[model samples]
Target: MTKRSEVHWRVSEFESGQPFIVMEQYAGDELDLFKKFIGFDLPDGTSLDEAKQIRDLLSRKLIRVSET
Candidate 1:
């Protein structure tokens, strides 16, 4: 099996009513599964930070659909 190296974010929004942040309309066959987040477990840690960093670094060289 092969893993997808790209992902497209269809929608990125913040919901105050929810406990966890949700990335809706994300489209990726396999890469999504391999993606690692730094703050997934930390309540104070911002997951968006990791996402943003990756976006900044890869957007110019690769395809990374990111939203902060």
Candidate 2:
């Protein structure tokens, strides 16, 4: 039998009202063997460019947090 691993994440909004995502936990025997994926869907009034900007900003912030 083969075993699979899982990763958990949380999404929340900043004080400024921007949304961000963070890794909450992982439950698996092999963290290296697991693949991670993330997705974002633009809201009804949001444009593609605005969505991209938000995604980029969130990514950068997360990266900074991870580095610290």
Candidate 3:
């Protein structure tokens, strides 16, 4: 991920067995991002590392927006 990046993870059955969109996880302050993800009501037992991984994966999957 780059500066000012975010992990916009949509809830998928494959990822979290849900059918909803996870909020955009702004880059920096990863701890805060994870806290937000947890609040989204992810499947029970989702760990901090799992949340981080989800964000990392999303940061890669999404298209890179050029910083103006």
TM-score per candidate, in order? 0.26, 0.35, 0.36
Q: What tens-digit string does per-residue lDDT give for candidate 1 at 1-68?
A: 55444543221224532123222224555454445642222244446665455445544454634432
User: Candidate 3 at 5: error in angstroms?
Assistant: 12
Off by over 4 Å in 3: 1-22, 25-40, 64-68
Best by TM-score: 3
Native-to-model Cα distance after best TM-score fit, residue 35 in candidate 2, in Å: 2.7
lDDT for every model?
0.40, 0.46, 0.51
Tens digit per residue, CA lDDT, model 3, 1-68? 33344445654433544433365654643443355443255566666567667756765787332232
Highest lDDT, which number?
3
Which candidate would rank higher by lDDT, 1 or 3? Answer: 3
- In angstroms, give how far residue 40 of model 2 lies from its true place: 2.4
Write out the backbone clash pairs for model 3: 5-27
Please give the lDDT score at residue 16 for candidate 2. 55
